[model samples]
Target: MNRETLVEIKNLSVDFSTAKGALHVLRDVSLSIPRNRVVGLVGESGSGKSTLALALLGLLPDNTGEVSGRIELDGENLLDVPPEELRRLRGGRIAMIFQDPMTSLNPVFSIGTQLVDAQRNRHPQLGRRELLKRADEMLKRVGISNPEARLAAYPHQLSGGMRQRVMIAMALLCEPDILIADEPTTALDVTIEAQIVRLLDDLRADFSGSIVLVSHSLGLISELCDEVAVMYAGKVVESAPTKILFGNPRHPYTLALLACEIDPEDEPGEALVTIKGGLPDLIDVPKGCIFAARCPSRFGKCVEEPPLCEVEAGHKSACWLA
Candidate 1:
């Protein structure tokens, strides 16, 4: 079957009116995620990854400044949709597994209540017993043992990994068309993190939809995503098929990121490479390249912001070199 474009984000820009001034979070960022594929958004903290996810779901803060751009899901413009429509679409057409599952879950509510309530938004006709059964099955699918007993427990009662798994189960119970996992494994250990990633991969067979995995771990992205968009500051500096991008990173920012990845062959006590300089202040962003201050290959033209242009077929980079 031919996969079609499921989500298209075009020229998206976001700014917030803080007490000090306007803080630009996203700048003309555009991306396309094909149906049934996993697209990874890899970037450092405060790179606008989570901001983009909220924008896609029409959940941006109302106090924010003008947000310009079109977020189209299955050819429908999400930005122009009504609030009620968007709310209805959120857990049904779209769902998010947040960075901190503990915070995402309500401490007052039992896990069963939260899971059942989530599904009830779409399946209000479901009986109490049926809802419990569905929640139990989903919990099992996410690798949680004693699903029935766990459902009766509160958020604090479970281990960090268990809570994260419950969050995953809740998000997937609705079977959304788009799943935005923003640092889903941030709180898990190495073993649990691997298990969570594997669970997500396995659940894809049951969910015929696209996923946007927002993470700072390039290794995780490389392993789970079909395509990757490398974000810097607030812009996408490089985007391409995962293999192609890793094999031939054309952008300076992307190359620097790749250089920081751990290598198994590296000798003991070798210091890992680090990207020079800090992220630019959003309130006083430069007119030039976002990475120009730290770019080793900086040139005269880099003093001007470069458009994200195609460097090769199906590969694009936002650099003067591209």
Candidate 2:
């Protein structure tokens, strides 16, 4: 099948002016999201996964961060659009389910009110009765029972899982072209996390759009993503189809991440292997390969940075070894 390209990011970079200096959060990053596919951004903390996701949505703080790059949606570059056009695009063609639903949701407003407000931008003509009906249906679709009662409850009244579901429903109510879920299952229990993941998996068929799932959990990415991009030190070190990435990872950073995945069958005394050394300083990122400091396979050639090179069909890795 010839899948459509829903979003394209080219030479994207973001830097923040900190007390110390300019802290680079993203560097020359580029990727694409195909229509109706779930792509995951996987990396440890400080890897700029969430930063890239926010950049896609134009959510970065204007004054604090300097962003340069083309965020192309459909055929037009979003950076070139006016603020009003970007605002219209946000809640209409694109929507985001923030990591913390509690913070994202207005504590004073009832769930129904929030849901109605979510659609207000796109459906101003919708009557209250019609909006309420749509909200109830979306709630039920996300596996929330007693949808009518839940709508009357405030954000504080709902459990973490329920709040997350409500947030998902809100993001999807308008049927956006792109859904950016930043750590959708964070802070939930194991059972609830599994449930949320399954719900998102089921949503693919119902919502005809692409999904960018930003997470650090390789297990969740492997289970839910059709493609994965591995980020490190503000750069994408590797990207490929999910199965290929797991079976034949190219970048040393990608392999290190796999090494850290916990196995249920491990002996009681077995210690989880951790990636040696901490993340590089973003304010002063290495001039050469960022992972060279921790990479066991690093060679003298790694002293110079490597551009993303295609190692095989549909698989690319940024490493001298590749």
Candidate 3:
């Protein structure tokens, strides 16, 4: 662990018990969440992005068969933390804004009740009135208009964008050191998504802690991330600073992702660039490079698994070509 990093995931792997057997969702994944930085986790669906995020908070589902490797919080391995202590750290030291507010928020509770309850793990001594006050302030901070009024509103009563904002407020209420926002804007419209992105970007000033943004949207990642880690088939295929990765992607998978991005400059009737193959089976993972079948640059060298080695200072890619 470094002085600047708040959380570190090293050699992490996860197995989920499905009907078909254990699905290896994550494989030797390592990442660093530096203090006061937004790190984006990007890749297509089934890339284990969400699994990695859930692992950070130790919130993996009960069906999770096995989880190996270290998740260090300030050099203390979170995997070793007792359940009681982990519960304390969950909302206080680390919070997460899940993908869908509709599903995450309790339908029976008012927005105020949920937000106030979110802080209970961290602020048990605070009375309901005090917690409600804190929740109101956070709602206002996240741009909720008429915060007091919205506090009484139920999740079903609020608009989609407003519900999402409430989720952000709930996450912020605990003043967590690390916030994992997994596809925070996935359910919103393009316009609302842009607003949410801008809001998160603006929050950097108010929040001095680290942020882990898990999403497949390269555009959103480029906009908010200080660094980006590109995952493919449960492995981090490439990791680099945002500007460097976006401007000069090294891995073939990363290059393919950027090429497939929807560009506004394309003329009418222009065909889109798309990757040729689908993701590999997690149960029967390839022995060699997981992306070889989809990689345009793969040759005989790809027959062997490539280590995630540094191609340049602060840039790492898991490809023989890199």
Candidate 4:
């Protein structure tokens, strides 16, 4: 692992055994996120975006799933850590904000109780009064209008946007070194989503920690991420600085994703370009490129899986043509 890297995933693979067979969810996925940087993981639904996030946090469901790889955090291999140590590291050194805030939050407990619990978990020595004070302050920082009033409310009492803000506050209270937001804004309205994005930007600026943003929106990735990784069926197809990936995408899958989004200046009647063919079933993955069936530029070489090769400085693409 690089000394300067905050989180490094090397040759990571994850699988789940079902009644049918073994489902390969992540295939040789590797990524490096440096300190104080934002790396966006973008792909369509069922592209293993959320799986990768959960794997990093060691939060996969037990009994059916298996994970293997080197997941190093701040030079320590988290994959090899003991269960007790991993538990301690989860909320103290790294935290995760799940996609559905309502589901992540407790419907029965008061928001204050949840936030205070999180605070106490991190700083157990802090008194109850101190924990409450800190929780209120964090709530305010996350843009809640009346921190005291909202703290008394249950998760169901608050709106979706407000619940998400509370979730962010809870995550921030831990002062984690790396924050993983898995589709954090997927359930909010446009106005609230923009506010959440801005709040994340402000938090990142002040916290000085690495962030892993997993989302399906290309526009959001372009606006908020410094670096981008494009995922296909179960592997990263391309990765580069935000500008480079958006300006000159080398993988057909990446190009298809970008094309699916409508351009502001496009003609009124212009039809969106949709990628033909659906993602391959994980239980029976094809031998060649996962995207070769839908790739417009695929050739005979595409029948054999292509390695992720460097296409340019700091840019890599997994495509035979690239």
Clash count for each candidate, listed in order shown: 0, 0, 0, 0
Give the Cα error of residue 48 in candidate 1, in Å: 0.8
For residues 5-110, what per-residue lDDT tens digits would candidate 4 score against the true structure?
A: 7888999988888888889989999888888788999988788988888888877767447778889887788878888877887768888898799888988899
Task: Tell me the lDDT of model 2 at 162.
Answer: 96
lDDT of 3 by residue, 263-286 (tens): 745421121236787899899888
Candidate 3 has its poorest 10 consecutive residues by lDDT at: 264-273
lDDT for model 3:
0.89
Per-residue CA lDDT of model 1 for 1-322, tens digit only, reads 4658999999999999898898999999999989999999987777899999999878898777978988999888898999999999986989999978988999999999999988987788898789889999999989999998999999999988899999999988888889999999877877888888898888877778789999888888888898999998899999999999999999988888878776644421121236777789998889899989989999999989999999898799999987
Better of 2 and 4 by TM-score: 2
Q: How accurate locally is residue 172 in candidate 3, as Cα lDDT from 0 to 100?
A: 84
**Alpha-carbon runs more than 4 Å astray in model 4:** 1-3, 264-273
For model 1 the local lDDT of residue 249 reads 93
The C-alpha stretches of model 1 lying farther than 4 A from their native spots are: 264-273
Question: Which is superior by lDDT, 3 or 4?
Answer: 3
Candidate 3 off by > 4 Å:
1-3, 265-273
Candidate 2 at 208: error in angstroms?
0.5
Full ranking by lDDT: 3, 2, 1, 4
Checking candidate 4 for backbone clashes, the offending pairs are none
lDDT of 3 at 180: 92
